[model samples]
Target: MAQITLDAPASHAPVRLGRLLTIILAGQFMAILDVSVVNVAAPTIRTDLHASGAGLQLVIAGYTIAYAVLLITGARLGDRLGHRAAFQAGLTVFTAASLACGLAGGTGMLIGFRFVQGVGAALMVPQVMSLIQRNFTGAARARALSVYGAVLAGGSVVGQVVGGLLVSADLFGTGWRPVFLVNVPIGVVLLVAGARTLPGDRGEQDRGLDLPGLVSLAAATLLFVVPLVLGHEEDWPLWGWLMLGGSVVVFALFVVAQRRASAPLIPGRVAGAPGMRAGLVTIFLCMGTFGGFLFSVALHLQGGLGYSPLRAGLFFIPGAGGFALASLNWRRAPARWHRPMIPAALVVAGLGYLGLEVFESGGVGFEVAMGLAGLGLGAAFSPLLAVALTHVAVADAADASGLLVMTNQLGQVVGVATFGTLFLSVAPPTGHALTVTCVALAVTAAVGACCATPLLRRRG
Candidate 1:
């Protein structure tokens, strides 16, 4: 329980940021990749395991809800322990869980192991931001954040593409299992590299963990996520509605508890940091829209249009190019331009989605339209995080990062639940589905733009 200040003095040698980013991003890529990678393989998994629709839903939702629920506590652990130590611990858990997921015998075991993997991800991910805050400053920090954003956004594409390849490859006749098993060797290498390369900074050991605040927040998140994830699949039963209502009440209780706790899970000052709240709202909107779009499009292409999994993933390739172009050129803009970038990008992305309507007749222009959408995604993706944390205190980086990530996961849940439902209701000739999803995304982007307007008025 000793506090170790690992930030070396000014006169000491500086660490290479590249080494740090590589180590952190490698672990993060693994975690983020898992989120979307499993999607393409869902059908294969169901066939191989004889999973029902509801059961398959659980397999996906379990990881997401658990990851969202435990994120704040994981952030606190990083603050109470060293970010480096906490990250390493998370990596170890995640790597082991991935192996278990590959080796699972049935839907129940895979779902259980997926939840454990979420816990590990919760522990590892927040520290990536905290470490960037701890090590980088000024323009260097901006660049680092931009890269982080790019990687985070790009991970989805990677996951979809890689998942398709893995499922198709069926390495050693393992079927969908290799998609997960591939992580083992990569994780082992990253774990070793991270331990040696990351700085050894310990947190305040004397500060006790806020047990009550933790419970309330966990309950609040679970209450919100579990219902949305299961409600539609379960046909919106009464208990799900009750849980949704209960989440609101529990969340209020959490806020009250946090206000009184001596060492609160998330300190008020940090939560109230300038631009932080607005940034979080913007992130929620953007991520939610993007998540919904991805989920709906995947289903439409595969289930409705009858594209092969690989072809379905390839349909997204144009968007990836657009994103890459935007991210690569992001640093060229002035600081003042950052705030407006998100809203503008959303508009562009929205228009791109709207363009898909034109391709409905023959699906001829799908790739081109998606390319435009990807461009919009690229422009705003990193800036969303950059603008959100612009004024956050370094000390609270881990907590803020955890909260930001949780919001993102929640947004994705909402997107999937709401839009996924919409897609399912219509079914076939997915042009209508595309229109519905695009309109919703456009509206969400507009909301994000509105939230970001205040941040734009403030100095960068």
Candidate 2:
């Protein structure tokens, strides 16, 4: 394969185009995989690293916070420096951080490394979407987007299953370390493949970094995420409340800073766009419920039902299949279906949850109900993503992409907090609490459906 140099045009021949897509998609798979893989490994990590409940929560929250904070900046940088350069640089950072995570000695070390890994992921993730817009056009671009959505959904399911297998296998007695170590071989292959196949940077050299906006945004995220993770563990301490309050203030300040900054981290016009605004809100609700459902389901299967991690992961396979099927046919689906699909998918997902609440006895019926939830999720996510990004301008594509990613992450954080809090507040045994959590999650999904209906109508 010929190396694609910095000066090459965006066009690709049929043969090379296949390689380009492979390189881009591989990077994307790694990014999405990181988000959910850790859930399966959390128990092992807690046992091995002697992580407290709080420490375990940080392991997840830290990564998400760093990833969310840096995403917009990463997108902006990509736009300024060229998507390919940003993508490669991001991949390199992510690979190194994964190794750091695998080698870490304690909970603190793992949390720190995870944060760094998220920074790299943030840098790489936005580039994936930007690359699609840059490299493909018209129907081809739409096709690429569909593939991207499928990969996103598929990667999440694969993460849980793969993490379970790796943990259970305990290859070389490394236990959960395999979850992080596994990325190295994959990353090496991606790097070599990307070097040979990815398109080069297309932007001019003079674009500068937005340091001030980056700092404020990071501060704002820490204020928001740190409090959420700590609040429940500490029984909502004063500092937690203070941090939550401060987050609002810092976010307000960040908004003011962005308005004044010449090179804002998030372009104001893009943020203000009606489609983007609706998209971000929709993503927040959808991802929040999705994230909570996954977390709750994992706990239900493992903690409540006493299933092994591998078995728990297997339960999600049907749902993953359903999502893949829906995504494959999404293009052929009518545009009118788009408006109603959001609510419909939510209703299905909610009913799946309701079924769990009503019929669950830790049996085959429970697993079937869970699969239905996945089917609903699959039906909802791709179409929703398409609707969200539909009206974004090409020039602001990277920024818009970053914002969408941020909302998704934020949704996960909020979901975990809201649902986790509800489950914990009951102070019941693990099994009962999980059941109640599923019910609460079902109700939340129903609310999401209601909110999404208006957006669908607006889009229609």
Candidate 3:
């Protein structure tokens, strides 16, 4: 098969970075929203379909399982097929799956459809970063990356808002179904726009897909993600522990397979990029705190404070807003400041958590605390990503993208497993549990700040 390098866009067609980013980002928003929106609709779904507890759990976990496991494979496919083709195909599958989920008459169907939806997300999401890395340069790259990070962070809040609104509005008395159906029109529009505007590579994949590496990696991801995601719910059963232990072996096998492959899924240059390890650690800690904070906070709000689901969801809007504002504009700071910004901003995030602990009573103080956290996080993430990718050749954009995204998903799972468990283990007095959890999250942020020394620090 014929192929061109990442630098070679198909000469037959024009590449519009602006148009392409818009379409791809829209798809990303939809995919991330689905991850959390379903939580708001689960009770209604149970009532509608008389789902057993296990079925409801499956409906949620199935998508996560498929998505997390297949992500690296999806990224590799994007590299081979061209990001545009992979993204479009993923969007098609997701849109169709969303419709099927909305129309499902039973829990089993919804569960199956949700997994298909995740498969679509896995195929599509890695391309967002790959495309940005390929098309944008200098300040433009920074800005595009900022917007990508905002969309990455903000999608969960928006999902909660949209899901709550749809359920509460019960549009046409469809209840929870509209949450799924709402994606249909948006997806259709993106599909059409993307087809017309997104750039494409002009050739076929040159090498065979890395089947051994793919299987090993998939197994490794499942072993880590499944145990993290379900272990808490399962009361940390023996099998989950075994899976966790087995993951080390699978990961070792994957690393060996990747090294032996003629065309590896993750190239060594991309993996060895300067600041790569620190970037991943920062991303992990950032996402973990956010995940654990989101989960435990929501529970505390609803059960301890007697807030409605919508209210609890809406409370997060301030954090999302602050994050977007910070991410979209923070690159204007001086070069000298960039090295120190990550740790400084993360310290701010730590302070925000502490402020929340103090102002747990609510009102402007609480909102302010949330916004402060977002501000710090948003300021840090984009720069961290930029610094991380500084040495990664554009040719290996897909590999960098896949690595970052996989690390992010892993961080969230681990965060939920640990912090969420702490929040749940305390009997009654959820306020106390929330306080304890917040303190722990704050401490984690402080550690992240210490750990997140950008490679630029040495240069500066």
Please provide, for model 2 over 249-313, each residue's C-alpha lDDT reduced to its tens digit, 9 standing for 90 to 100: 98899899888888777787878765566656766877787777777767667776788888888
Best model per lDDT: 3
Per-residue accuracy of model 1 over 1-460 as CA lDDT, tens digit each: 1111223335333454567777887787788889999988888999999998988988888888888899888988998899999999999999999999999999999999999999999999988888887787766677777667667667887889999999999888999998889899988988898878888886879877899998999999999999988988898999999999999999999999888899888888778888778877877877777787788888778777888888888887777778767875787988667778888988888788777666743355877878888888778877777777877888888888888878877887788888778777775568787777777777777777777777766753
Candidate 1 TM-score versus the reference: 0.94
TM-scores for candidates 1 onward, in order: 0.94, 0.90, 0.94
Candidate 1 stretches with Cα past 4 Å from truth are: 1-15, 361-364
- For model 1, name the residue pairs that clash: none
Candidate models: Cα lDDT each: 0.82, 0.78, 0.84
Q: Worst ten-residue run, lDDT, model 1?
A: 1-10
Residue 349 accuracy (lDDT) in model 2: 83
